[model samples]
Target: MTDFPFLGILTLLPLVGAIVVALIPRRNGELAKTIAFVWSLAVLVLTIVMWVAFKVGGDRFQFHESYAWIPSWDARFTFAADGIALVMLMLIAVLTPVVILASWHDVESSPDGAKRSVPTYFALLLAFEFTMIGVFAAADVFLFYAFFEVMLIPMYFIIGSFGGPRRQYAAVKFFLYSLVGGLFMLASVIGLWVVGGHTFDFAKLVESVNSIDQNTARWLFLGFFVAFAVKAPFFPFHTWLPDAGGAAPAGAAALLVGVMDKVGTFGILRYCLPLFPEASRWFAPAALVLAVIGIIYAALLAVGQNDLKRLVSYTSIAHFGFIGIGIFAFTTQAGTGAVLYMVNHGLATGLLFIVVGMYVARRKSSLVSDFGGAGKLTPVLAGVLLFAGLASLALPGTAPFVSEFLVLIGTFSVHKAYAVIATAGIILAAAYALWLVQRTTQGTLNPALEEIPAMRKDITLREKVVVAPLILLLILLGFYPKPVIDVINPAVQATMQDVGKTDPGPTSVVANGGAR
Candidate 1:
């Protein structure tokens, strides 16, 4: 674990790049963008290298590094990558480059006919990437909380500066909701330190705090859960997502929904369950109820959205519901599926946002009514959109299908009614997905766009380069998920053990169709 400080390098590389890009003259937008892309690409390469060096099926956290920051308080600059963190790290590394590509020109010019400085835009992006890596890598609770809250800073600027007409409103709404959530998590973090003899080390906190009274533990669990649920933006707390997504630039929206928002679910799996086992069991039923409601409500709302970006955002809310259920269901398969869902959703939804950006770039609008027979005009772009949308719906042979299936089957094994109701989300997903495709691609061309040659042009080479990998990966993981599941299962099994539960054995059926 001490062989090299790979995690530190992975995080700081982006931070340094952001600083470098920021220092470059504002007029050198192209130069700033190039440096940002190169740095992001380098980070991606290093991440791949880290993945190669990572020893799967071994220690729970590899590439471990820790340094005392405040010896008196037991807070440390700790970092590591478990299977879950590794997957998220990979998602961030992969998406950052894609986002750099997609936003290359979009951020240089605004929708209101104003030119915006590109350097600041890309700089914030890199900064956002740094915090994302830190959030996934931080092993200490204090470090995690710091990274978690710091992430909102760059995102707030990205939306407020580079986003749509209501950018300020959206950005402030996002910031306030996230800040409130962070406050709750902060309280919980302090509570852990007080209860655990003044240590912020995650393992130590878990060992010490578990012995605290049940009532105090439950309060701590609620503090963390409320924060996570808001970040996951589950059900009632999810109103901020559509506003943020609808207002932010496509690239920012992708990272927001894809990688950063996932910190919520990750925190639950990493902290809530293991550190507060009895409290988790006490709250699982209620959490499951909210999860199921989020699934149905978000999907229905997605169906009614006319704006493309808002529609996509609602789907994300729905997808998070699936992930939430998986986490709370307490089965190995379900937990594994939840982690896998995080990765797959990043790919599918990120691609969707990129595609929508392409559409908005050409058509100058995101309303469903603004596009008609787009497939006839831009077959490649339309095809990619449909592919991503299908993946979003969890169609068979797409990446989401595998994870969604595992979640459902595993949930059914434990809580049959929640699983049954959650299945309806799949139906709603298909309706919205197909509706999106039909309205944008299958209908007659809108007369307003008939004479616009740019509207007819297919996606560019750069666009293809950005989206092709995501599409291929969705298909690849859909067919073969063993590599991911192998890494995730061990950690999930350990988590279940900590929570004092195991997957129930499958029942065998007799030839006469009776269960043995």
Candidate 2:
């Protein structure tokens, strides 16, 4: 472990930036925005350096740093990065700047249609980024819980204060669902202390908790599982996603779905399985069933949606189901694919939200019916939207395709039935994505929209700049994911070993009846 507190600095830099932005006079909105963007970019640069320095195939938690916060309770402000956390941290760092640029003109307005204070808006974004980094980097269980709960506050305000017309309802709903989940997790956190000695350090908990009886461990696991499932918003608990996504500002929605919800899956991989291995295995079947159902059901719902933002949100729910399947499958390849899926999903869905936001900005509506022949008016924007949509559907030559393929291949090795059923989501994904393009860009121009000056214009240079990096990443990762896969595979293998599982041997045979 290094003595340098790189992880702590990475976690706090955004918070410090938020403070500075907040202190800036509200009258200087542009200055505040500039400062916040620069700070977020600096955070990205630091994260890139951290990535370069990370020692792959070494200690599970690199750049470890710890300082006792409550000695009696064994609580500490500890932080580190494994391959999974590093990937998520990179996602947060990359998306924060892209979101900042995407929201350059996404001003909040009063009921009378006057623009409100933009400084507070950007400040909240920075604060949200702070909690996001903390959640991924925290090594102590209590620290993780604190960051987890604190993250909801900024997102709640972002949605309720700056979102669409039903912002309050959506925000409150999002808050309540998340609060209930967090409360369930709090109970589990307390239970861990009581059952596994009073240590809140994740490493200590994992070392000590094996003595817990099966029934007790299962209950504890359920407590954490419910919270994660709700956050994952799997199946029955997923009603909040569409409402929240549809109502939030595009940047906020992107982070909400793209980066923040990932904590749920990350928690399951990081805390749930290692700490409650037997219980995780015991519940695997039930979890897999829900994951499959979510995959099929959400995809069907997405196909029926006419609202563009809500459609995109539904697609996310379905994709998360694929991630859930990968995680629970207990194969190293599946686990690596799940983690990779988190990164790719962020890029593809973030681009989709950005493109949709551009359309909404021009048309002032997200209804699919409100658009027509937009491809003719803005060919570059249309092409980007099509590419993003292809990525969302896991088309060949896209980042998602590689990840999704690995997930299915890995799952098929263990549970062929589940893998087969989950594949339906891909076809449904194609349906919804192509339908979106057809309705919004292929038909004759909507007469109502044709009269609008903004609707007639092409994508702006700023929008192109904001989207270009994500496009490049999707293509780059699609072709050469070895760099990420190499880092991920070792961590995933370790996780599977901890869970007492291993991938089954390939069963296919050659024509001569020899193993291939």
Candidate 3:
């Protein structure tokens, strides 16, 4: 077995960095920023090394590490990475540094009228990174849940403390929603422990769950599913997302709506499906139906949005609805597409928030109307926004295009009507996306905006540094995604095997071929 200590070190690195950064003197803002950057970069390098060493060929969890943390309850400080987790780990690694740089200009030593320490904000942001990585890497269910729940503490502070005017309301609302959902998931986790012979090991739990009574399994599954659905912010459970998104600082919002939301869908794929196959199958259609409804309903809502950030948030909800349906569709293409969509959405959405934050910094507004004729004022910023928007709407040459196409093709195979409904979301996406671009970037210059300052100094060098990799990948992945799809296919195959059937069909081949 590969050394577990290395895994432990990887997990703890960011947390340690956070603590160190927090302790840095307040007057040493430059020092604090430098430390944070170095810490984030160090963690990224460590994660990359871990990735290089990770054995993707085997379907079993790799980089296995465990330590007794709660013997009575059978909990352990366990962590590992499967292909799915590995992808998430990589995404986290890439995004952390980018986000740090994105916030470099904004998270100042003293940003005039800011309450409760700028240093604290950076520290909390760093801490959140640690938890996010832990959630993706944890091999033990309880450990996973702990990391997952821990994420909210920092994110709440980030939004409520560092965010906009309604930050307090939005933060409290986000925390409450997440707390209730997490409690439901805790019940499910406890149930899984009891039902699985008091084992907290994820692999063992899955095996034990396969033999449980279907009725009991359904309840357990719902417990987990409801929590994830809320995190995924699906349909009726998604009321808090726009508010949270609108209120959060750009960097925090990127992490929340971009990366954290994936945890929900990931939990469904990793735990819910393989562990509760019968329930998953039994409920797949219902979930698909709800997902379709979310897509259509949220897309319609997006069209009417005046707030740019909120509108983008609604679009994410719509995109996630597609992801939910894709996962539950139980087709390889759909599942793989969903996985790719997770990463693609993170990059695209994070870029969207970053760009909008810059625009707001200059224009002093998030309203779509306030942004009229920005293309004339800031050509480069407008161009970047257009690029980010195209990726959002799944333009054929962009990242979302391939993933969404695969999702639809996969879903259509299993449920035609649901696919058709979800397809309409594409039309709505196009409308809102193009309309947003036109109103913000293509129209005549609004006289009021002329006095607002020239597009935040035309996207700083640091900003360019932050977004460059994401943009390059968006272009690269749109045409080629074999690296990710290759890793995902084996895992998806393993999952499908556990679910009781296998098919080497058209969609399966395409998914194996990677985002074609």
Candidate 4:
């Protein structure tokens, strides 16, 4: 009931757990697994408590914590949670434990009787959680950049150490892309600090940054935007995502792509728009175009993919395109839809990876052709897969429907032509989604696959536990979006207001549906 800085405690708990797991003797793999699960679960519980305690009616940051860390340089130990941060926090809190469970049996051994299996994996995963939460909770620009940059390490190791054949290549490529972006973001951070009269506190910086020259601000904004876009893996920068997702383990892919990737678009919404309002408006048209192109391009690619995992990866690229469009479009509905899309995409995408992992575990392959008639052989798994796929494709009554509808509605107001073009992506989505289902679940049983018995009778109780919340969330949020929208709308409206007053003539017509 106390209004103390509970959010900071939630953020630190996982870091404590990670340290403990890393220190545990390597031989104690079972012990390490149990401890990691408990720690991740505890963080989840604390997050839920924070969510319940959060004041949704408040129109500003809450649980604010600030301390002077480097006063001479104008930096501070600062953290806070606004509605946007809360949603991202909840996404990370819910998904990390599920991913840990999915990787339960993935403990590996080095040669010479070294027993370093699950401890390393668990430690790195928890470390990633710490950084992910830090990104969302940070109230200081320098702290946010530090967390954002540092997150690359654990992810790099996870993919490189435990991924498929091309693991090394994928890991290196992912790291290089992220590192280059991070460096650029650092430059932007420094520029912002300087522009804001040497203050790194995000709220103060936002207030003082108004006087920055338009040209310099635009470049600085792009520096930050590029880093997030690379993370989001937007369009051309997205080449790394498929390779990374294709090569990584299912649990790693789920967290990396599902929750981590959202940080990119989230950054655009949280920082780029608010801090550089003029730049955002100035660049909106171009950003919208790229988003539309990415939507169609990635969807088409998904349709052509033979690898189930790769196809899902491509599908995410398309989903992100919609999110990016929504952010740059800058309408209240579009912005709120973008936030909801992040949550929905995380759940739906996470579920997809979990099901795909199960299938891969049995078939020893991720190829679509290798999975024929799986529905007949395993009804429960097939049913969950079907549900997951439908939810992903935005089936009505599922989570993504409302978000997608909002994005389209929001975009129609400002970018009607692009929205019309982007509508085709929905049709393309149906094609690829249905194709994935048919290829794996509906066809006649393959002779090679038929010889192998279904390893699992149905989704494991654990599997059901993992998916049920997400499925429930998808359904609940799709219909009862008000709870989320209420918190999100005020934030989005405030951001839009920061970008400058909205004109009811062309701007409103284009952004809200009047012109369209």
Worst 10 residues of 2 by lDDT: 108-117
lDDT of 2 by residue, 412-470 (tens): 98999999999989999999999999899887977887788998888898898899999
Every candidate's CA RMSD: 1.3, 1.5, 3.8, 3.1
Give the per-residue lDDT digits (tens) of candidate 3, residues 13-112: 8899899989988877777878888888888888778777766686467888788899998889988777888888788878877887788766552234
Model 4 Cα lDDT, one tens digit per residue, 75-175: 87788888888888998998999888877765474222344457888999999999899888888888888889889999999888877778789999999
lDDT of 1 by residue, 1-516 (tens): 336889999989999999999999989999999999999999999998888787777888788899879898899999988888998899999999999999988987778888888899999999999999999999999999999999999999999999998899999999999999999989988988888788999878767855788999999999999999889888788999999999999999999999888999999999999899999999999999999999999999999999999999999999999999999999998999999999999999999998998898788888999888988889889999999999999999999999999999999998999999999999999999999989988889788776777797898999989998898899999999998888788888888888888899888999999996
In model 3, the runs with Cα more than 4 Å from the true position are 1-6, 109-112, 454-456, 504-516
Q: How accurate is candidate 3 locally (lDDT)?
A: 0.85
Query: Candidate 1 vs candidate 3: which has greater lDDT?
Result: 1
Residue 437 lDDT (model 1): 89
- Scanning candidate 3 in windows of ten residues, the lowest lDDT window is 107-116
Structural similarity to truth (TM-score) of each candidate: 0.98, 0.98, 0.95, 0.95
For residue 26, give model 4's deviation from the true position in Å: 2.7
Clashing pairs in 1: none
lDDT of 4 at 404: 91
**In candidate 4, which residue ranges exceed 4 Å CA deviation?**
109-116, 454-456, 501-516
